[model samples]
Target: MARVDLNDYVYVNARVRGMRSHLLTRDFFMRLVEADGFEALHALLEQTIYRREANEAFLLNPVRPDYDQALTLNLIAAFRKILDAVGGEPRRLVATLLSRYDVQNIKSVLRGKHGDATASEITNILVPVGSLRLEQLEVLAGQREIRDVINTMHAQQIKYARPLIDAYPDFTKKDHDLAVLELALDKYFYRDAIGQLKGKGTNTEMVRQMLVGEVDMRNISTLVRIRGVRLDDGEVENLRIPGGALSADEFLHLDRLGDIVRIVSDYPDPRYRKVLQKALAEYQEVDLVAFDRELEHEMTRRGAAMSNLDVLSIGVIIGFMWQKNNEVINLRILLRGKAMDRPQAQIRSDLFFVEREEGQAA
Candidate 1:
């Protein structure tokens, strides 16, 4: 009873809290955003915890600044450190959550292979924070044929390979559509993740809540993406992820959506309804920046609230992970914005920051 009261992830949370403390403040991001150029950005990054890897990244890619690669490498290293620190239930919970990255890694490989991108280019974009190690993904990325990639995964007994194999028939039928493989990977990940999360513990509940929100966000994004596209109902049916706050019926409503405002009006959660309102107001055809940015902010805010709630449980870990992710996102935007000579105002507009009060970390 005492340990239960203290929570399953008590010790892990302490370490995570320390890690979260190192997260950059909004003021730091402001300075980074306004930095003169890649040289100025490198000088500033050298002062932070990313200093070592950032320097290493620059040395490895001396011909280019490679801020994108530096930031991604740092993010991957941070997540791997946490995963290395824990065991038992805490480990399982964290690993399952991070499996989303596995989905991302696979999708990047498939897309790269389908699009004829070189292995190095594909490897540059991967973070390898999930079951798939960076080396494993690099090898997969090197495969000349998409079929070779899938076959290699099955040969190596990768857990995610089966669904991709099942989905490949559809891919061949549909003119090598990568979306089919991507959506199948998503469905497999959520099903497996949610299954692993089945329990009544506080940690399980909060993490499941986060998963639900993710499912809802992905479902809505899918609806929005396929709205004007030439996709069929069968295609849309496979896109709705199970285990979200929004119901299947609600998804059906969103799919038939004609009035743009109805998307904002119809969503059940007023929190996300407001977010949709913002996205809707700025909604442009095919450009997902406004929508993706707003939705990501809402998710980060949710993570922040959860982090504040369960000091000894999985909430803090999940929340900090998202914050760490936001750190990378913000840095990437700042780096790219400065590199491109985008205005300070424009770069600031693109960032999704945590809301802090009374000098507290969000």
Candidate 2:
């Protein structure tokens, strides 16, 4: 008999490919852009796969924020849909990738608490699709202080808590600087992921490459961001993530160049060089936010490209993850545009259009 993992992939890959076919297409977005208003847009969405969550959102508050909540729930539902469909090593890889959601939830909660946001405000921002249960995150958000949040995490035995706990002193030492702690979590998540995916195999290597790609872009983004922050020069070294096309020496060397455009324009690598070119061309000064967005778009584009790989490979799951994320974000943006009564052309300009390969219709 074939290996058990192969058996799992036969079913899992079929499920994923089938789901990809049903993802929202350009045609759907065009209609969405032409939607009359928020209610009309919600009405259109309710007629599709989002009906359940859209209805739940309507029942919750019947406004933009609640609709946003519904979208968040819907996105979580999408990931769970795939997770529930797979088993064995395929499931492990999926779960491993899903850990990023947990990291994001932690960051959202910490940032929200730091800003004195309401509990609901924080919870609404979370996707709750990772190992950390919604209740656990809600409790974390409910904590009065950031340290208390970290402490409660330990009390609850959250795996990510230890790193934050270890870094808490530095957080305090840096005058309660959130970036220090946030960077610690980033390092922990990526390092732990790379560590688990250490073995050699085609599928495992694919996932490793996906992760290292993230680390590379994030390190670059971090390096760019440090220029605007008050942190010590050592912060770049501290935030470096190993095993990407960009090296530590390259990162440090680039950081010292000072001019954001010149830093990227003169870089040796054509791949990363291409990514920032468009965004840099539009910037008169450093716009880290734009660079970050450009980087995220590039990553998603590359991750989504993996769907073209072998059917039974982990690429399907990885590709779906990225595309699904883009789909939801695009939906939210399109609806927001409709709500604001923006013209179709303007809204279309801002949306991330997912072009299908010639014969592949959505």
Candidate 3:
């Protein structure tokens, strides 16, 4: 187990609070639209949240590669700073989130292989922020087959690699294997890491409850998508990740989606059902992206609510992290929208505002 000095919360929270003030707001997104191109975008970013990364990133060309490289470097640097501030076990705990980069790298490698992309092209797209270093990710990408990466992972005692190895035999092509491997890795990694954490005596249970709720929402989304694709019950079940708040019995009962509505309604927290109802209503007509965004916004609001409590625990840390990540994501969305010349309404629709009421309800 990684060592944790619980008393360090004072220093940790102070640093997080200071950093939180720098996050971009709705006003920032409004200003980003008028920027000309990548260069102007780069300038704006440098002036705002990414001053440090942008400065370092400018050492190279301001092309797409440099922009992405700087962004990735900036992200890892910020994440590591938080870890260092917290130190000890919290570092290891927060590090679990970076493990998602392994899944991201797997998807990128498979996509590149499918498209017959050059190693240079693939390397540029890969975001390095995981337990595995960039060199390690590059090595995996250069391997002749998935087994090479699996073998490397096995040698390293990466517990999450087993599912991918088991599913590899079923994969004849890159797309299927990447999808299956990614979904499996997400479940295995999060479950193992969250299960290890001591969540007692704090809003830990509340936050854990929120994570479990997210699993349920994700499961719902998966079911809807798979059903639309005309997949069979068995295939769908095989694809589903377990350990959500939903019971096996409840999930099995979801032969029809009305069961999902009922199940969500029965959740102990009333606001979840209220939000789900509104989101699902929109989802029935439009695409699920809106609903997905709503769910995330709701969860962020829930985390923010927990952060407001005077208690010292993982709640504020987790809440602040979500807010920070949201800031990054919202900026990316805004930048992409500006690049593509999307209308403000369309871009605004995609933004999920954290509601104080939703947080309080959580």
Candidate 4:
């Protein structure tokens, strides 16, 4: 076969664009808010883009499952189908993006095992859209201890399993270990796989900027959460992941100085600036969940905007993937809203709009 070329991206992007169109618009959220229960929500989804998965899941769960879980499984299937269709460099590229899912699953396995959660609970929480198979995660979840999961991962060349293995001995602080392992995995994926494209010309810089900015925001969020939880300096810095725009020292310094506002005030990067501002504001008034969702929305908006650009590199692909993920989240929120009999207004407020204006709450 001829080498994979940028030409293949055209086909992949085309497929992604079509998939993107099926994502619920802001208007759709407004309508979904009126849904009465899981059944009503299911009816709405069946008429919309989630029809295929909704139909399939309804048969399995019979009674409506949690909206988010149903939505997640559906989205994973859709992503898988798209990957299969655009099988080539397109597949490889998206695989890189989804690798984070494996990291997340591992984190879940560790948490579940530590908390004595049942196998079903862990399996339900896992999103199998990444390099790791769902069966693998299921197997790990069945293990009596976390180390067994780590051993299972060794076969896949997912070196992240090593840190989890090493950290298990001192796993008394479960949250700290999870954070450290996740940060380690995030840095490893970028530095080893994505980061090597430091100066490959054409749109690579923009892509790199987005990824690095994302890591920076994640680190900042982590710092804020740790501080909120009253973690001491030693514990906080130990949890810091180093591949972002800020050095480990700088992240700690910024956190110590109560300098979040100043740090984000004139931030040169637009993507990071918007997110930093939202995070700063939310942290002041609300809880970490609000700050996290706002920051996440900011990132998704940036990725979605990048996808629409005329650039030919992976920008569009990244944007599409981000948007798809958002779709899954949105559906989950709607389902939960319906199940709880929450008012439409309240549910709508929880939806994250990537393209939303900075001033708009939803």
Candidate 4: pairs in clash: none
* Cα misplacement distance, residue 356 of candidate 1 (Å): 2.1
* Residue-wise C-alpha lDDT for candidate 4, range 44-131, written one tens digit per residue: 7787877876787778778755555667777787778766755555555566666767777888887898788999999988889887
**Which has the higher lDDT value, candidate number 2 or candidate number 3?**
2
Please report the TM-score between candidate 3 and the true structure. Answer: 0.82
Please provide TM-scores, in order, for all candidate models, with all chains considered together.
0.91, 0.91, 0.82, 0.84
RMSD of each: 3.2, 2.8, 4.5, 4.3
Error of 1 at 22 (Å): 1.5
| Residue-level error in angstroms, candidate 1, position 159 | 1.9
Residues 146-210, candidate 3, lDDT per residue (tens digit)?
A: 56667877777766668778777666454455676677776776686567657574544654565
- Minimal lDDT window, size 10, model 1: 1-10
lDDT of 2 at 193: 83
Alpha-carbon shift of residue 136 in model 4 (angstroms): 1.8
Which scores greater on TM-score, model 2 or model 3? 2
CA lDDT, every model vs. true structure: 0.81, 0.81, 0.65, 0.70
